[model samples]
Target: MSQVVDDSRGGAGPFSRFEFLVAGRYLRARRKDAFISVIAALTLTGIAIGVATLIVVMSVMNGFRDELLSKILGLNGHFSAYPLEERLTDYKETVGAIEGVPGVRFAVPFVEGQALASGLTESTGVSARGIEFASVQKLDLLYKSAVMGSWDGWDEGNGVAIGSRLANRLGVSAGDIVTLVNPNGTLTPFGRTPQIRSYPVSVVFNLGMVEFDSFYLYMSMQAAQDYFKAYDDVLVEGAEPPDVLATDEEIDAAYQRVYRANAIEIFIDDPDDIATMRTRIQSQVTRPMTMTDWQQRNETFFSALQVERVVMFTILSMIILVAAFNIISSLVMLVKDKGRDIAVLRTMGATRGSIMRIFSMTGTAIGVAGTLIGLGLGLLIAANAETLRAFISNTLGVTLFPPEVFFLSTLPSKVNAGEVGLVVALSLSLSFLATLYPAWRAAQYEPVEALRYE
Candidate 1:
C-alpha cells in the first residue's frame, strides 16, 4: 500500500500530494503544440463573451420592465374602484372610508370618457379623465410630470390638460380653445346628435411614453360630469338635480345620504402589495366585478416580459454549453499525451484514485479559472453598458437603439447579484461535467501497456 502524505500542510516528502503538482504543471508547462493553448484561450474567451452578453441582455430587460412599471403606476392608480352599475353617488364618503384602509396611500373619485379634440388643422381621439383639481394634485405626480402649464388651471372654467403628442396633432397650445365632440351622444327626438363642447387647453404633459402622450387628457370632475351628463345620475335621491347646480349645503347633505352605496377607489404606493390588495378587495367588495388594479389592467405587457426573460436566459446558456465541449476535447488530448507519465506514476506507487484526482483537479482548475474570468467580464460590462453603448454609437455613427424604434433612448442595465451567481455556477458545473470522461480514461490506463508504447 502506498503511504499517502499530507503535503497539503507542508508535512510530507517530495511528490507527496496529487492535485497541486498536476494542476500547476499542466498550467505552467510549455507545450510543443501551441494549438492546445490557443484552444483553451478561445474557450475562455467564448465563456466570457457569452456570460457578459447574457448579463447585459437580462439587465436591460429588467430595466425596461422596471421603467414601464414605474410609468404605468405613476400615471395610473395602483387600484381603481367603480360602480358595478353605471353610476356612483356619495363619492366623498367612500373616498374617506377607503383612505382608512392600511397601505392605502390616496383615494380619489374620478370619471373618464372618450372624446375627439379638433383644431382648425387636425383632430385626434383622446381619453379625458375628470378629477378634483386639489385631490388630483395630492393623489398623483401629474403636477410634477407636467412639462407645461399648471394642473390648477383645470379648475378654471372649461380647462383641460392635453398630452404633448395630442397637442402636436391638433396644432394647438395651452390657452388655445379646442372643440371636443362626444361621438357617443344622447339621442334627441329630432335626430341622432353629438354633444360638442369647447375647452381651453390648461396644461400639456409629456410622460416620455408615446402611447400615453398621444392619448391622455385631464379635466375637472365638475367639467367631466357636465360633459358626460352624469351629474344628476351621481346625486342622491332627494338631492337637487345637476342642472340646478346645488349649493355647498345641498351638496353636503346629498353626499351624506348616498355615501354608503358609493363605490370607492383606493391607491397604494407599493406595487408588490397591489396583488394582495386586489384579491382582498375583490373578495371584500360587494360588487366584485367593478374593482381593478393596474397590474390587472397591464397583465399582457408584464407577462410578455416574463416570457422574454426565460427565453433569453435559455438561448444564451447554449453558448456556454458549446464552450464546455472545447474543454472536453482539450482534456481528452491531454490525457492521451500523458498516458506514459500516468503509467510511470502508477508503477511508482501512485493509486488509481490519485491519478483520477490529478486529471480531475486539472480540469477543475480550467473550469474555475474560466468561470471567474467570465464573471468579472460580465459584471464589468453590466456596470458600464451605457457608456460602452454610447461609445460604440459615437464611433459607428449610428444609434444602437433609437428612441423612435426603441422606447428607451439609452441602454439601461441593472446587475442582479443572484442572477450573476447562478450564471457562474451553471458555467462552471458544465465545464466540470465535461471533463469526467477524460479524467476516467486517465485513471483506467494499464501501466505495462502504456509504458510499452513509450
Candidate 2:
C-alpha cells in the first residue's frame, strides 16, 4: 500500500505532476470499473454534441435572417413613397427632387399593380412593376442577376422582363410572348371587363428569392401605363366628343393626359439612417406623400425570426445542462470506485485538497477536450452548411430546404464569433461546477474508514 501511494504523493503544489498522473490513471479505468469509464465517455460525447448543435443552429438562423434581408433590400430599395391623395402625375419632378436630397442615392418612380400573366403552358398572378430603361439600369441587383438574354432594346422595344421561375412555369423564354390580363379595365355601359394584352419577353432574371422569382415581373413604364390605363384627368362620363374640325391644340389636349405613378422607390446611402432621410425627403418634396421603410414593411417577419432564434438557443442549452449532470454522476462513481486508492494516498501524506484537485482535473480534462472538438466541428459544419444541404438533397432525392417553403434559394450559414465563444464558456463553466460536489465528497472521505472497508 505504501509503495502504491508513494508515486501519487510526491508533488507539493496544487494540481501537480503526481496529481495529474493519478487522475489520468483513474480516467483510464481498469476492467473492474469499466462501467464508470463508459459513463465518462458518454459525458464527453454529450457535451461535444450539445455544443456543436447549438453553434450550427444559431449560425443557420442568423444566416437566414441576413440573407433574406439582403435579397429583399436589393430588389425593393430602402423605402417607398406613395401619394396621400390623387395620383402621382408629377412623378418626374418628384423623383428629381428626392434624388437631390442629401443621403438619397436615387429615386425611381414606378407604376406597380397586380395582374394575371399567361404563358403558353401556364398562368399565374404576378406583381408587375413598370420601370423605365434608365431606372432598370440603376437597379444593380436586377441588372446583374440576369440569367438569360440582354436588357438591350428593353425600353425601346415593347417587351417585358419576367423572372426565371415565372418563365419556367409559363414555358417561355426571352423573345417568347406573354399575355397580361388586367382585371381593372375601362368602365363601359356593360361594366368593366378584363383588359388583355401580349408582349415579348425581353429578358429573364433570377432574383434567388422564391417570392420575387415566382411572383414578380417587370415591364416598360409606358407599357404598364397603357395596360393599366393609369392616367390623370379623365373626361366626364358622358362628355361631348371633340369636333373633327377642332384645332390641333384642342385635339391634343382632349386625347393626351399625364401618366400617373403609383409610388416612388427611394434608395439611400445609409439604410440605418432611414428615419432622418425620410424626414429630409418629406421636407424637400412639395406633394403630400406617405413614406414607409423596409423595416416597417417587414416588421412582423423579422420579429418572428428574432423570437425563433432566442427560443432555439434556450432549448438547445438544456442539452449542455443535461451533459453537466452526466459529468457529476460519472465523477461521483469514480470517487466511490477509487475510495481505497484515495485513502492510501491520504495516509501517505497527501492533503485533502490534493484528493479534490485530482478528481476535478479528471472531470475538467473531459470538458476541455470535448469543448475544443465541438468548436472545431461546429465551425466546419457551419462553413459547409449549404454544400451539405445540397449533398443530402441529392442523396435523399428530396429537397431539404425548398425555396418556395424557405423563401431562400439556398441554405445559408453565418457563424458569429461572439456566439461561439458564449457556447464554449457556458459548457466549460457547467462542467467545472459539476465537478465541485463530487470532488468535495471524495476529499471528505476518511482514510481509516475507507481502508477498513477495503
Candidate 1 lDDT by residue in tens digits, 1-454: 2443233223254333555776678766465746766777777777777777777788888777777777677767777787765456657755765666667787777777899889767988888878887766775556676787777656666788887877888988888888999966677897768989998888888776666777888888788877766555245656655346768776666653312223345778577787777665555444334677777888897898899899999999999888888888888888887888888878766667667777777776777787788788877887888899899999999888776555654566788878888888898888888888888999999899998856
lDDT by residue (164-262, candidate 2, tens digit) is 889999999988999999889878899998999999988899988889889898999998888888786565455555798989776666664778999
Cα deviation of 111, candidate 2, in Å: 0.6
Residue 190 of model 2 has an lDDT of 94
The local lDDT score (0 to 100) that residue 124 gets in candidate 1 is 85
Q: Give the least accurate 10-residue stretch of model 1, judged by summed lDDT.
A: 256-265
Best by TM-score: 2
Pick out the ten consecutive residues of candidate 2 with the lowest summed lDDT: 1-10
TM-score of candidate 1 relative to the true fold: 0.81
Question: Candidate 2, residue 139: CA error in Å?
Answer: 2.3
TM-score list, all predictions:
0.81, 0.91
Stretches of candidate 2 exceeding 4 Å from the true structure: 1-14, 233-250, 253-256
